[model samples]
Target: MQEYQLALKDKRIAWGMAIAIEPLIGKYSGDSIRPGENAALDWNLPAGVYRAKEVVMELDKLLEAMLVQLGEPVNGDPAVLLDSLQANLAISGQHASLPLGPLALKDKAGAELTSQAVRIGEQLVIWAREINAEKRALTTYGAETLGALEFRSHCYGHPLIPEATRLVWGPLGGPRIMQLYNEYLHQFVLLRDALLPFANWEEVPFEIKEHTEFKGLRFLEPAREIFLTQLLGKKLTHKAIVQYAQSVVNSGLTKTGYGFQYRLGTVLPAGLGESAGTAARYLLKWHPVQTVQTEETRDLAAISFDYEYDDYYAAPRNEAGKGTTVNEDTLPVSREHYDGPSIARLLPNADSDRTTLRFSLEMEGREFTVDLGQLFRGHRFLYRPHGNDNAGDALTKRTSISSHRAIDILSHAGLVTNPDEIHFIPTNGNELVQWALLGKLYPENVVLLDKGDKEELEAAYVSGKGFGTQFLVL
Candidate 1:
């Protein structure tokens, strides 16, 4: 055995034998070998068999050491090595490089080698199961820890390459192992980039940070650094901003007139400047009011009720005469001395020419009355007579007053002085849009009932905007 080992050490001899045994190797290894190519090869002859001696020898020592490390005992028998190699090859095709024939061991070993090989084979089976479990665990870890996009893009390939598997089961040293390491490191980089936009690194779990398989990657430190730098002093992350937007919508505020008219205050971090508000406007579905037109006409009316009595009550009373001794209470009293005209006389002309005209406007539960004579004196009052339904009372009606006329009337009544400023009822889309636009442009002009922060409210007040009052700030 020693002489054979020394002779095989020569490069020229080893190369010659390797070339000569190629057909036999390919046949047992399941590699594509030409038909009838190995028919000329004779395993029984020493010359034909000796060519594979070096390969068989190397495989024997390697397999024995692997089995011994796994606590399986081995005997120095060529047959045992062949049987164990065959068993491993059956389990995984990558092990097909090991020879299958008994040419090297037929003269030197016996049947007992088979039993010893079975023991080592059992250990190999257990090791293979462990490796498969580890691979599954690593795959799961990658999926859970990495972002969805990154996992799909970078980590979706085969879980374990043959070289990576070999590195785990044995100390297989080569460039392939380094190459696999680089691949894993590159995946870590993608993971870091994927999470940088939204994830808060301080909240990451320790299991992800100290992952057993990827612990050597050292990706967490730099990832955390970059993440913090990008999000420095920011109160809300990208994920948080999305959640806040959803919350606002859910609150039913977006459907309101002043929904998008309010300020964000300190809800956002300083890192995001004024531009963030613009982005938030779209998220909040802000549409400011454009041009407002009145949809309906309201009437202003003045009404008066008149009372009448018979003149017979005023007839001179007959004293002590039996001509029906006047029961003064029984006769109707005269209405001539009354302050107003009699209902009987006024009822016929109440609807048309004789009706006294006036304008009555009510705002905020207070009523203001203006005489039509005075109102139409300096102004060209355009009005249409609105019909009256009540009987026995005189009422004068006017309908569809223009906004300018309304403003002037309000000013004359001392209700409002600014004709340019208008209040938004926000009953329709256009009005709501106008309200939002006014709030955004002239924030001080709109009264924000709830500012969400006392300090912010005070600041707005200090800046000449009424924060809580119905009046405009300026």
Candidate 2:
């Protein structure tokens, strides 16, 4: 690599190997272009153009082979033509990235344990990309370095040779394939570390800090972020934020909490400075823990559960609940889908506390749990409606919020979106006449009484009592 860099300039080069890849018509450099700039740059050809004649000759023959494949004559601007061909080859034969499996948590001995009672760091695997080009593919250049160029381009995330130059020079050489792969792997690892994603709560990890996955929470949208900022623009609370989250169904709670200033009593910024109130990336987790303490609470044979696929018939040899049924079809379709996983909220002998909500799914002979609160903690911010706050009677825009229920009130009262911000608040049973001045329902009360989504309510009620798991509708 070092030797070729010294003499790469001033060589009239034909760059590229395939037919469709348009050749870079001008000189090239390590200088990456700006966001909107054109690809062409005014490059001064480098000095050493002589010592590479032999490899360049071999490139001429390779060009002939590529031309034959394209059914085109090998007679034009060699550098440009060859480069165009290589680009086309790349487009047609692009390599694919491999799929990453669910992140795992395992003991030093590699045993998977329940999240409620375990410890371990999350594990990640890195894979390398393929780089298999041909020597016979090089054509008409003074230096045949197609392979070397391929490896170098990927390593730098920038192309080494201009498509035009490669036609005349590619077959000469490129960076070591092994070395390039290693560098790519190292950089990707660093990039992943920097991203620091909020956990996917849906997976129901077997461990706490290690394999936590959020089930119902999805990425908080920018629009919702703005709405939340408007709602609690004065000061934010993690609690009110969680309440607001119930409406979105699959979404997160803002990680923001009240921040205090000497002048102000207890306050939090919309999102400190440039962040717009949504950017304090943190370490968060969610996982499930199962207990086998009592007789009735344990898995049972007498009360066999029904699902789309597979059935249970047997019980443990002793008193403990046990079964040997296997079915892949019953897996949770969406981590947030409030259907079967209700086991955490249903089974008579399930959860220990009212605060716990469980998302369940069975995969590969193992049961998984996704907790709502755990998922909320993983994200940086929560969604809040902008317009409403406080108990109200009049149709004031700023004090009232926008919600599935409140939408009717705001629309009928002619005060929707009139305020700079709005927020959604879950409805609690309350009489509007007593809470209002006009002797009618208050605007906030309108939403509180807007019982439109009955199915969702029914599902939540079932999940909450049936399996000791509750779904906060958001």
Candidate 3:
């Protein structure tokens, strides 16, 4: 194994293999260009032109292969065609960027498309630049001097890479699990060092920072760093570690109570800046050692007594309040009868002439009808009847409605002919309201709600509880 490892270290041999992966290495370099640009920048480019020329030849072959696959005859010779452009560059010192089209060809699917042309073109440019760079380096520096460079550049024999390779190519399973554990372990160590000063306090105003994953798997969106920050000075807390753990768990479970707008399955937690700070502050307020202990004890006591009480009460009573063969099935179920209109009857009247009556609905299991007029009564700044020019209710236009619920309510009311026409603006402040507002009854029209909802409405919007259902009704 040592000999093989040492054999792999031969710079000449390594360089030969490394040249094949040049594109992968240069994937992020500034010199990357499209296939058309590849031909234009062939000669008089840099020290890597020879390797880049080789890559261009490979690209032409690949393009020819693709054309053959598509049943298109390979007509023009790319080398011959680019000869003039290459000459123009040397003579003119400035060349026009030529756009090579039809480089990518694709068959479109419904509302989606898959193409390989751009990817292939990019790969060609990267490989060419990388191969050229490596060739230049080998020629400039002797083989003995290039050994360390080859080893480090290729990252050969790194402890983690071997393990990663084992996981990727080994017969054993759970390499990913191991890798994740190591990543999290490293993160915890970093976090521990950061929080070492405040690790002894009972409670500290702590915030979790989000870190982007610079190694391993990447995200379409850059991930944020997560670590607890001491908001109350630099003081350490006795519960700092516990609070940090709780915050980590909480962030994992509820996305730090920012809700599920952006939840990922990675064990490492993430959070938004402002919202995460708000959540951390809220958590720290009740996250002391005493608070956690008290809550736990209280919860345990409540569970114990509740179970005992339930067992005692449900202990199969008869004429003497003793266990009996006549079971608890004989117990009568209580039903509270309502003397008012049923929910179906109280659903917003489709043809009601009164503006308020058109939007009012008495939901099932609730005693009162939800009156849109009363709900928005004096608070016209936050809501209004649609199509009304009330200046006080002018703020309604700023609030967004949920497209999903809007379509359902409109369809139920016989108002919308095409449901797909209803679109929700994700950028609006009411985006949360749109997702949270689960209406009890459908309606023909929707009332305009403003961005500045009251605290009660805001709470309902967050929890999807209470008469927040009414927020979506017409």
Candidate 4:
């Protein structure tokens, strides 16, 4: 048992060493060498190459043993790892070391090292991104749940769960899950920050932000449930909410050229019967009439017209059977009559053309024309003046504003008198917290749309029920 424990300790060290060596080699290998600099003068090329090969081989053996000991089948491809290592080593050996050709050898080694370092760094970044995605998936579905699933599958003697998943969330997965997650985050941040210099040197764009930090906690499942229960009552299911949200997203608001159109509408209680409540009107079909007002007129150019006389009106016909051409002297002229104002004297000035969107809706006996474009700009919900012309851009920009502030803006415009009566358009998961906050504030009246609601609505439409009876018209 003592010997087994020592062997386990050695394997753990080997695993840790492999993780540490990845970034270390990637960083140093990519270091920039000045034009006159020699980075490999003391590298002992052949000896260094031999040691790297041995270290790689030993790491592979140790990792395999460690995985097997943990009852997890090895999933890493040895060939891919070997290829990466071999490529880097080959780059380093491109320069032959000779006593007489020391400078040539060193220069060649330095250049090749820089090239090889870049390739390693790129591969590292790709791996980091993939691992981060996996981490997020784990976070999305809690560690406990994942562990339980893996443990159950393993006990059933089925390979339903991936080996990595099993190793991470199986019987011994509790502390290791957090340990691995934290370790990966730390390594990712280190790598991301370190690569900044290399990115600048290579003129490549790299995101410096640490995006792996949890954001889902801001709008937890319980909060979602409470919001839904309050707004939808006990009659609506979670699936209904998701379906509504998805239907809104798939509504093709962008393709219809509807611009930014929204309505303050009400929906009947979940089992109240559609005939009893006011149906939400489809606002996308409402065309925005463009009214142009000429604020100023400017003189453009003098207008002129050319006229020809008939053969009978001409002086006489020549022998060629053509009427005699009338010159300024032979033509009869009429006295020029000046009207009150010449139409040619003034033209509509392009700079003075003021175009406005004219659209109005009447709700609860109150007729109001909403300048959505103006409202969005006034509230800084949209930074670009033309952003409102595209429904997708406008919706995306609106997410920048807090849901509470958005409601306030609508209230000020008289579009939202009661928060409970307003059904906000569906937004993506990134903006869930914003809309969720409003749902919490006015729990009874506000219906927040989610992706699932959209999906449910879509399925209903596919059944030929027009926007799905489950979805509230908005």
Candidate 5:
């Protein structure tokens, strides 16, 4: 883990986003059906559990519709949404022991969606639809409805900012660099948000026209002088200035032809059904699994844990952090932020350098930043993994992620520890005891399970061939 973290900090390695998909098997079937749909059931009983492919498809469609409503182009890869979705399942032996839905609060439609599964004879099934207090089928935010709501206005596309604009500003008492929707220009807003006290960025409306028109027109005079002086310093003529601006607008940024593509009226993560504090959404899709009517088999329920890690996106603290509320923000954490160093005793090297560290991450398909030193020291991240795809020609892919990238990502994120410490040999069940003995000599040494090692251990415990996956075949 230390080595990987060092690599990330040194820019020797980097990773993209990752996701986990798991099939959920519900316990409700027969007359035990509930009035609302939750993670527990799909409302389509007797068939047992829901299919992962179908659940992903449903979610994809839902997100597409929502984006279209937000005025995003519906065509092209929907990677923006798919890249951030993760698979989650709730499992427990007793029907009532596991956390079930309505995992979230009631939506504005005044309907309660539940997570109830039942057993009919030898089969377990789930409820897929939503039911209201009157037991009437009503439209609500569920697997079926995409949780769609018109909370605010949104638009995608950049405003046309002319190159001739110029103005003056304060603070430095000199001209600053200028651009037509340039990244450098946007830094001022970010700087203000970070340093300005009592910054209510959420209440600050985003207007592409205002951005393009240079709302505070007076500030640009100094910026224009600086831009012209640089051009003249290079012995360039007026023609050069126009050409430079045009070239930048053409290719310096997104293919949308703007260095900073303006996506005004942006919706926060919570507006999209993400639980407060998490950039990703938590959903349980029920799938049917066949079970024999044996004493042990009858009472046993399967459980598994998976996680997706790559980077963390740092949006406004009020939008997706510890203090965000479910009413306004979806990414809320249950505890305070803690991403600093862990106890020296818990690490392999207590004397490792701490001055050089990097904690860049992505959240909800957006760039996010957080204090790693403040996070890992106090918080443990829990995530869901994308189930291995088993389709023809794609079966060779063991996980949804590229194996090498997954290793790199997990290590840098501090979710996996000491990749070299993983052993393929069978355990004698004394690893924990051995760790205590070893700790006597190496106080900083601690046993950490890398992803591969954890998978092997799980497979051994479940007597499975691969990553001990649990999915319904029906």
Candidate 6:
């Protein structure tokens, strides 16, 4: 595609973070028989789909007298509450996630005293915020009980801020992180609204603390991350875990900028669900491959595509000029309140001394700033954009991300000039049209991920510098 669009304006490469896991309920079988317990038409017909593991052995001895008071796995990890005791149990597809007796929205002694005196039983995080009624501004957040780490304040109505969203779990050790509890975010929004589906639970009934964010859109990839690892304790794969949460969502609606792009699709491409401009709550857990074993299941109903790239939203720069910098330590696209005092003082080529000019936008992002030598004019970025990466902060820890044609600047920032949308940058080996397009190129732009590429951008081009994992599986 024009030699990958001249390797992202030439010079600047190296990028990593390649997470690919696929599998969706490998052996699902919920709610054994929704139409009254015992006689489901003598196993005949009136309805068909079900899988609470076919009534988990007839609600396994009253589910230990109703979750023996619900406890376990805040990190102990032996699969607790079988997914909050499977929304009041009742399965029948092939196996067992069948608890089915308390949470139908209260009753049964208020859902078995909310799984025993207010979940004194640990793990059920649930942050999933989205804000923005008009311009409130939060947009997206995650943690609906996914390796939480910390939360507390009667347990939650607002206030989790793990630095405001970017906690994609997969590795934790000791002290975990969850304090929040408000009846466990209201029994996880009543077990995520009684498994949704009642015409989408009256659409938007809200109280506040209730939340969830899953993406079972399953375009395919997730059948063996571990296969229901004892009722979801690990072997994780919410579709490579929400594509790592659609890579941190940049969906500002079109334009070369889907940077942290991840699609969910059930509606709300930019309509901003929950009856507002941003109450936020995207879900899409579709099972069927005849119940998820994978292989040809594309009705593709649930899809998420916001931030449709402004069309000319910006990034075609090349107003023609000079802009040099062999990387002496600039990194300041405007820190917080900026118009132009930071970007290392600008210098379209301080005084020339070469064929046209040199380059260096060094992939910045705090606000905006990009000239990078105006794309090296005609000479064609010398030796493939020029050589870059490890921009001192974000770009997935920098492993492989050079520049010259970075999937055409990430399909022109995500305007998707095709190239299959370029995703999967294992440090910099390019495989699906070749990866390496880092987070948010604009929606305010988001970089500074992990950090490492050739000693963090050759020590910031010779001294600019930049800078863990155990396992929580997700």
- Which is the better candidate, 1 or 6, if ranked by lDDT? 1
For residues 136-213, could you state the per-residue lDDT of candidate 2 as single tens digits?
333322232322222221222322235433433445322333233223233322222211221322221111011112
TM-score of 5: 0.16
**lDDT scores in order:** 0.23, 0.23, 0.23, 0.23, 0.21, 0.22
User: What would the TM-score be for candidate 1 when compared with the true structure?
Assistant: 0.17
Please give me the total number of clashing residue pairs in predicted model 4.
16
How accurate locally is residue 340 in candidate 4, as Cα lDDT from 0 to 100?
Answer: 14
lDDT of candidate model 2 versus the reference: 0.23
| Candidate 4 local lDDT, 309-330, one digit each (tens) | 1111232211111112222222
Which tens-of-lDDT digit does each residue in 1-474 have in candidate 6? 011111222222222121111332222343211232232110111112122222122222222211121233232221233333222222222221222222232322223322322232121111111111111111111122222213222323422223211121212221122221222323333333232211222121111111122111111112222222312342332233233223222122222211122222221111111111111112222211110011244322122322212332453322111112122133221123322111121112211212111112222242222222222111111112112354444232322222233323432432222111111112232211111122113211112212324343333332211121000000
**Number of the candidate with higher TM-score, 1 or 2:** 2
TM-scores, all candidates, are: 0.17, 0.20, 0.15, 0.17, 0.16, 0.22
Count clashes in each candidate, considering only residues at least 3 apart in sequence or on different chains.
Answer: 6, 88, 20, 16, 67, 109
List candidate 2 stretches off by more than 4 Å. Answer: 1-99, 102-175, 196-452, 464-474
Model 6 Cα RMSD, 1 decimal: 21.9
Could you tell me the TM-score of candidate 3?
Answer: 0.15
Q: Pick the candidate with the highest TM-score.
A: 6
Could you give candidate 1's per-residue lDDT for residues 231-324 as a string of tens digits?
Answer: 3333323323323322321222222111111111001111111121111221112111111111232211112211111121332222111111
lDDT of 5 by residue, 1-474 (tens): 122111212122222111111322322233112232233221111222222222222223333333333332322233322221111112222222112233332421111111211111011111111101112222333333322221111211212122112111222111211121122122222222111111122122221111222222222334344433443244432222222222211212212110011111111111111111222211111111211112354321212111111122321111111111122121111222323221111111112211112234332243323232222221112212222233222222122211111112222322222212211211122222112111111111122222323443233222211222221000
